[model samples]
Target: DEPGLRVKLAEGPQKFYIGVDPTGPSLHIGHLVPIYASAHLQKAGHQPIILMGGGTARIGDPSGKTELRQMISYAQIDKNIASQKPQISKLIDFDNTNALLANNADWLAPLNYIDFLRDIGRHFSVNRMLTFEAYKQRLEKGLSFIEFNYQLLQSYDFLELYRREGCILQIGGDDQWGNIVAGMELIRRVESAETYGLTFPLVTRSDGKKMGKTEKGALFLDSSLTSVYDFYQYWRNVPDADVERFFLTFTFLSVEECRALGAAEGSDINKSKERLAYEVTALLHGEKEAVKAREGAKAAFSGGGDKSGIPSEKIGKAELEAGINILDLFSRTSLCSSKSEARRLVLQGGARVNDVKIEDAEALIGMADAVDGELMLKAGKKRFFRIELTD
Candidate 1:
């Protein structure tokens, strides 16, 4: 019900495409909804072309963003795409005969500007473009020409793919409805192609904030960026109101089963959450990692989890010897963003070292804290980390 399709699908199966720019080092939880939608499409016996927006990343899409995005170097974009490959593979099987990963940079980067403008830009109406939500939102702030051209380039991608792969449909998050409709119009006007555009609702919590974010940041799929334990816990502790909606969106649980689980009273609802955590974690990281993460959660809350699996950072031996403050240590560990935040967490009784809550912000770490090269640093009740002293 959440996938709010904009156009009707044909009576039979068809080929389609879905894409995302590698704007960051890894895809976050926010990205899973569309990717999962692609998976459902793949299972329905249709060709799924996974588009990598290398060309578009150079010019940020302003659909959901409020301001100009900081320009990123090509080197960083390549690294970001490389980091995203594994995550995408886990969801959309590239080995399938119908599945192909295409990069828009291949076609867009080499375009002769004048030729493209003459052939493609002529089809677009600047007057009609101004009416799109993506551009209208930024008009008061003075949208840049480079950013304004993004929709045209993206429209060109759909046209190019339609020719090359027979990809007749495009899908994305609801924020992309304007862009997708633009692409559909481009294909129809240029090739008289019967193309389609569909968009899924942006996954949102009952409270209205977009799902897949924590106080620290977006929940990234990469373990190095967001630990497996933390990833599992993010789902494990979602708001009771969010549990069923997340189950309906993220997992394969049937509607009746989701209803049954969501309707549980009191502490029983936690079981449904645990199931939700395991199912989503398994979808992203595999069942083995999900099992380990679940056990980690149990150990952590039931006194202490496996210290080795907790997210950890190595402190320089000299820094430990000289007595590094607890505040700075948290800042360095990705557990907290700054010393001030760490101090507040410590003073408020949310910071812990070796299972004991910190009573002061000035607490210091040294060699003695390390037991077999690890010490657990618990942030409040749900997050855990390890501090390793090293030379």
Candidate 2:
């Protein structure tokens, strides 16, 4: 049995199970703590059941919310589940293990409204349910009946898993403690079986902001939603104050190893952050992709002094023949937000043409400006765009 498994099974032997909601197609860094915890439990020779809350997602959980979430369509939910499979596979070993992937929709979707009321809904106490943080907040802010049933559905999912898979434990973030306990209670009432709930602390930034989100947006595990380079950079830029907590919750690094990395301090702290980024990225993506992402980051930051260290994009010939306005070109290529921003950048000498600063806001980039059938536009010190002069 796994070391951590002994703790979950302290009183007696119990099967471990964990769950994640497919609220979104990609798992963000915020979801990493529970994911890593589940993976740890799996390695400890306990069963891991990854529950995709397809049914529950339609009636979004009110946990940690100021308002109810917009309901997503079934088609969209299916699409999200399809996209999530690859990312989930990267962390958990799916081969020849007692691991199972289940969708709550399998059971929840088929239940008639009347049957659900009699079979599952009757077990939940209205007064106690209202006491849950998620439900209480919703009621204070005027929650809908649809959202109220979310916990019941989630609890039913837990009961079903407990009966079908012999899953004796459910784990999630601190926010899900009420829901987890609700499931445990339901199992006791309905089947006279005792179940357990364990939750990890919610991962957050040093500044008290939620993890996996930056000024840009949520740092998604899916490379398509967020580029691998940006994903790696997000982890690499964790504040020194939060690095140790991140390592403890996000990586499989032992307590001693995490302590050593945390104690590095000052300039040496970046090395630990880099290793964190690389390992975290490699765990989600592959090592090769992480290496490429790091290379891409180095190339973008190394400046013109080292052209080989920069990531390059290509443009076409006819576009240059049409005489593209430098501002318009920059905006079209996503180098700047708008033509005005591009013009301001040019006037401020922040815009560069083929590594040469362009001081003229009205600069006309024609075929004459094309170098090797391409015009490399640099916005600020980091962003690069290649304008291909077609025909």
Candidate 3:
């Protein structure tokens, strides 16, 4: 398939697509693989059709899930797609003549059930579908009928694209291998066209943890979900072994440049990490935000750099004068989601106020803790939040 696909790609501009389901309000770093791959292809002069899975998301993709996906309302799905559009546009140029934004809902939502069942459903085999890893795993945990229909809908999406856009290629995460192949088969069976599918390997850290995962959960592209500072820090703090591979895979940097940067040792490696962090953050959040994030990280670590980039909030001076409980303070910020979590963080010595460890959960944060009308809170070694004392 690779050889044939390469031959086709070498011929000229080919329309290729990658689908993203708006399951969440924000796209996490885990979702970047296919998006980056699409970017590379687009750069190579291939036309990109970014398919928003507004329709298929309703049924929920069962791939890589052990349980049924929580179905979201159509309104929420629309909102999710709108929210993710800008983030995706940072990589793939939707404004370009060669690029297209498509919604499967445009077609999938209006199809008659009986017509679809009789026409498209006839091609799928229950035995063959069950053999796929996605369903096989879900069957043990109880796969829903709706989820079982996801593959068919996804396969039909390919056929639809083939007919409508002349898209001959589908690309996605390796987990989507079965679905991609099914889509290719569907195109062949229905349109009798030779289409292709490409799946990228699952990205993981050298420590065996999934890439883009952080203590707070998945590293989101949305600054509101995961602060730009934290997003930059995730790459900065990546395992030394992953620096090279990440640069090669995530960034649009030349392969030669990525290797040279990855080959750095000792203190120089930190610079490589910083560069990788900056490039990635800049790609997603713009250079200004990336620079701010980098500066924020430096201030957090070096004790004397610009702190404006750190995730921050302002509080009334009277509040600090009256004093706030350590747990309450940390919980109010992004550091801890709740009081109990804040208590654990404090008790575990992961909470700090202006560089001083706060071991007691009941410890008070008062005006005295404020330095030059600012209080810096540290959660663990990496996360930092700043509080400005306002009059």
Candidate 2 regions with alpha-carbon error over 4 angstroms: 1-13, 303-313, 321-391
**Regions of candidate 1 where Cα sits further than 4 Å from its true position:** 1-10, 314-322, 365-374, 388-391
lDDT (Cα) of model 1: 0.84
Candidates in order have lDDT scores of 0.84, 0.77, 0.93
Query: Please, what is the TM-score per model?
Result: 0.91, 0.85, 0.98
Error of 3 at 105 (Å): 0.4
Query: Tens digits of per-residue lDDT for model 1 on 1-391?
Result: 2233333343566778888788899999888888888887887677788898899999889887878998998888889988898999888888836788888999999999999889988989999999988889889787999998999999999999999988888989998988888998999898986787878887778777768888788899999888898899899888899888888888877899988888887989999899999999998999988988888787667856454555667777777778777888888877798988898899888988877777787788776766666677888877877777777
Candidate 1 Cα deviation (angstroms), residue 187:
1.5
State how far residue 375 of model 3 sits from its true place (Å).
1.2
All candidates: CA RMSD (Å): 3.0, 3.9, 0.9
Which 10 consecutive positions of candidate 2 have the poorest summed lDDT? 303-312
Q: Can you write out model 2's per-residue Cα lDDT over 1-391, one digit (the tens) per residue?
A: 2355456566554566666667788888777777787787777666678888888988898888889788789998888888887778887788988678888899888889998899888888889988878777777888888888878888998899988888888888999999999998999999998777888886767887778886447788876667676677778788899888777777788999987887788889988988888888888888987887676566555532323223344556665666777787777755566788788888888888778777877777877776666677787765565554444
The local lDDT score (0 to 100) that residue 263 gets in candidate 3 is 96
Candidate 3 at 379: error in angstroms?
1.5
* Ranked candidates (TM-score, high to low): 3, 1, 2
Q: After best superposition, candidate 2 residue 157: deviation in angstroms? A: 0.7
List model 3 lDDT by residue over 212-287, tens digit each: 8888899999999999999999999998998999999989999999999999999999999999999999999999
